[model samples]
Target: MAGGGIGGALGGLIGLACAVLPGPAPIAPVSSVDTSLWSAATLERGRQIAAAGDCAVCHTAPGGQTNAGGFALETPFGTVYSTNLTPDRETGIGTWSYEAFQRAMRKGIARDGSHLYPAFPYTAFAKMSESDMMALYAYLMSQPAVRNSPPRTKLPFPMNQRPLVAGWNWLFHDERAFVPDETRSAQWNRGKYLVDGAGHCGACHTPRNAIGAEKGGFAYLTGGSAEGWDAPSLVGSRAAPVPWTEDTLFDYLRTGFSAEHGVAAGPMGPVVAGLSTLPESDVRAISHYIASLSPRVDPAVSADAAAAHAVRASAAQTLDDEGGRRIFESACAVCHAESGGVGHFGVRPLMGLNTSVALATPDNLLHVLQHGIDRPATAELGYMPGFKDVFDDRQLAELASYIRARYAPGQPAWRDLESASARLRAHAH
Candidate 1:
């Protein structure tokens, strides 16, 4: 009787495992899709959607063909290579039918019925409208086919199991289409749809749980990290010394620079580039929606007063860290010094007002110091030369500490500067 009972229990466990293992059936491949069948308007809409989604940013590898996909995305689990989006018959998605594409987007399942990792941001894509999805499909199918097969993602141990993703999906994936709120204005709703769906801003800006699912509810869009840089909060908790108005946010998104804020750098450079393709109305709507999340409280000080305060603070700290001050004067003062007014580049952003200095951590500032801005958002903007070759870890730390003290006087001094600089330098190489 004991033997029979043990056997039955083991059999039941095996049955349960088998039940979850079977995924959806593989969709049949197509010989070729008729690109001519899609309307011009549909293709244009698809292009806009792709830009909003930042599809090319992930799919296209450095110095690789556009959409041919060999980009390596580093994640907590392992490195995942983005697959080719170009419609090549052998190596790309040329054989995929609309059903296959839709399933992959909405369900995180591939054409062969294998589960896709959440690194693709399909959770956000699932919220996209059916019309938009269709249009995206048409646009991708219409692209020039390139035969390039990206490296397959392989995780270690338990994570390597594909069926395990079913459980992950059950817990995290919503798989629901976007529903507009009736109480909100048309523009607000439109903005929400784009932000939540194609924009997937939360993917980078929101904190994630232990299992890698994005933390929602009160934790949504508070702050997160991407590619070693801080993705600051979009809400009231943002580190910007000055509150972001819709106008300022729009300027930042539209042109990648706001005089009150700072220039877009690091991972955000590509995001800003992608946003530049969007229409003025759409960009405004997104800015408006984001701005509404963080209502500006009156600072009660005039701009002139603030500027004077920063100057005084900066001057006072110069004595404390003479070495840092000297470095800044020789290396950074040409453009950043108030007395100079403007650098040779014709734009002068006040250090006190820059977001990087105001941030609680010195990560962003260090990154800028190391990498510099090779690609300014627009041609008119000034290019920043990296100090990686010129400054050692000790020097970088000193410079960052000095800048933070001078610009953001109210904030506590950052700790572990040398360690932080070392870590950033290691990552760069």
Candidate 2:
């Protein structure tokens, strides 16, 4: 009797383990929605959500049919091609049921039961509310379907196996939908939902672990690099030249440029463009939430820090080299040295107060020199041409070093500048 009881107990334990081992339930085809039945307001709402999510920026390729994806997204492991989100019968999600779309967004599973690579940012999307998810679905399905097949993603070795992604998801994914903080005000909660869920700001702003999953909690939004440009910290120890005020942050997010900071470029340009379409309240909410993340510094404290930084910069200027000085005087001074006036192409920025110059890292400066600023020309803003063609690696290094010495005195002189310049130049072309 004792032996039989032990055998049953062991069997029960094995059964329990088996039941809990599987991560998410196997996905099935969701019931299709009748597009005609979707309300016009719902469709419009979906359009706004999609814009906030910047879905089209990643999905649409340059000169390609909108939503017919072909853009190559570079990752540490390999390049991942964006998929065709358009509802084409053969090449796109035309056959995808609403269930299938939800599974992909919330569970990172493709319509065919294949696990999607995290490059699609499903990890962040997983936190979206069910209603918003459905609205996004409606909007995507309503778009005109284009029969364009983007190139297949070819990852090397073990990463090529779709089954491996299942393990990755199990390790990093949180299956719960976003829950609001009841203690917080409605506006704050709205901002959190927009940024943490659909906007997926942390996808770029937050650092990742070994598996490319976001490092949440205390490390969240403390700055991370993406596609060669550093997305500076949004919280503690803010990196923007001038400390961010709510209005300034809102303006920057809404217009893509701030008088205090600088214009958005690279990946940020598209984000700003998308945010421009969102409601003024939505943008203001984002600014409010971001500002709330870090403690506000006293004006005197900020002034002291600035003064110290300037003193260090002044001391370092004494060590500037003649070659770099000559280069700056010849090429950089016309715009940079003219006091109380706009920069080249009417850009309103001061290098001394610019974060790119004053920041500890030289990467942002390198990026600007290599690629330059090219925002859409408007009555208010102008463009600055890149200097990659004119400046060789050595000369560029000298110029960069000189600028750092003059504008950001206390920062250490950059080493391995030649190598950095070479890499930037190679990638530029």
Candidate 3:
């Protein structure tokens, strides 16, 4: 009777677990294909879809094979290693059936019935259309199957338990395809789909709750942290003095640089680099959608905007007795203050107008100062050597304060700069 009672309790526990799950268990794939037999156009479309999602950016490790995974994505919980998407039967998704793949993409369920961590950004992918999902799957399966197994994710204690993720899904996951807004223009709708669904821009751009789940509704895509860099706000409370026009956004997205905004650095650099591969129309659509989110007035006509743009200190004012200015003259003024000339390194520095210095928070400026800007994706853009070794915490603070005051005059002084610099330097590793 005791044994019977124990068995009954075990069965009850299993039932409860199943009930809490997002969906039924995925069936294992029975067959394996050596080659993708998809049409050329379909394959090409799949390639575009994969690029739109920037799949390779996360899946591929630095100097590693494409989609071979093993890239470590750091989260508040811990580090989650990316899974191989190649066609390798053992280490990758080669054995995954269409149903299993669909469930994994839309519902965050793995083929063996394990819960995939949200670091995979499946929440956003859940909004992807069925056709796009299939196309992405095809593109990944067609890649050369690298027989590499990535390290398993190691979360702390209770968080490591995979079953707990079900509760996370129950609270946050939306297992549905994207539904277009019929009232909006096709370009607008397309942008919405790409941003909200396939591109999952909010994964990095949107701030998150305490649980690391992204905050939705009004808090959507305002600003967030990526890796370590603070992703500046994309709305009207944007970092730049001159508001982002669709054309400027398009330029930044397509080429990783805008004359007005300066060059993309840190995490944004790679993202824009990947975006360069996408079609111009798609980038334009994304810009249009993002621009619609904010109520920024055109910088051309707004006198307020013109005044803000003119906030930078004049050359004479740059020589003030403030310790910040003295430091800038000694260290920063050479390359940054020098004007238009020739060749890659000869390109004039974008002070005063740089979006990085103009941001409300000094985090981006701190990031660039600590790590420096390196545009390796395009050698033509040149690079800025990191001054972390050269400047101690106090010096770094003074330098950041100087840049903000001299270049971004209207913006208030960044508070607690010394502590902020110290914190940033601590994480520089």
> Please, what is the TM-score per model?
0.91, 0.86, 0.88
lDDT of candidates 1 onward, in order: 0.82, 0.76, 0.77
Put down candidate 2 lDDT per residue, 187-230, tens digits, no spaces: 88888888888888998989886557789799899887778777
Q: Scored by Cα lDDT, where does model 3 land?
A: 0.77
The regions of model 3 sitting more than 4 angstroms off are 1-19, 34-36, 302-311, 318-322, 338-349, 375-379, 426-429
lDDT of 3 by residue, 255-361 (tens): 77666666777888777776777788989999999989988557464435534454434455643438777777777777666343333462444677677787777
Which window of ten consecutive residues has the lowest lDDT sum in model 1? 297-306
* Best candidate, lDDT: 1
Error of 3 at 188 (Å): 0.4
Each model's total of backbone clashes: 0, 1, 0
Model 1's TM-score against the true structure: 0.91
What is the alpha-carbon lDDT for the whole of candidate 2? Answer: 0.76
Worst 10 residues of 3 by lDDT: 338-347
Candidate 3: residue 101 lDDT (0-100): 85
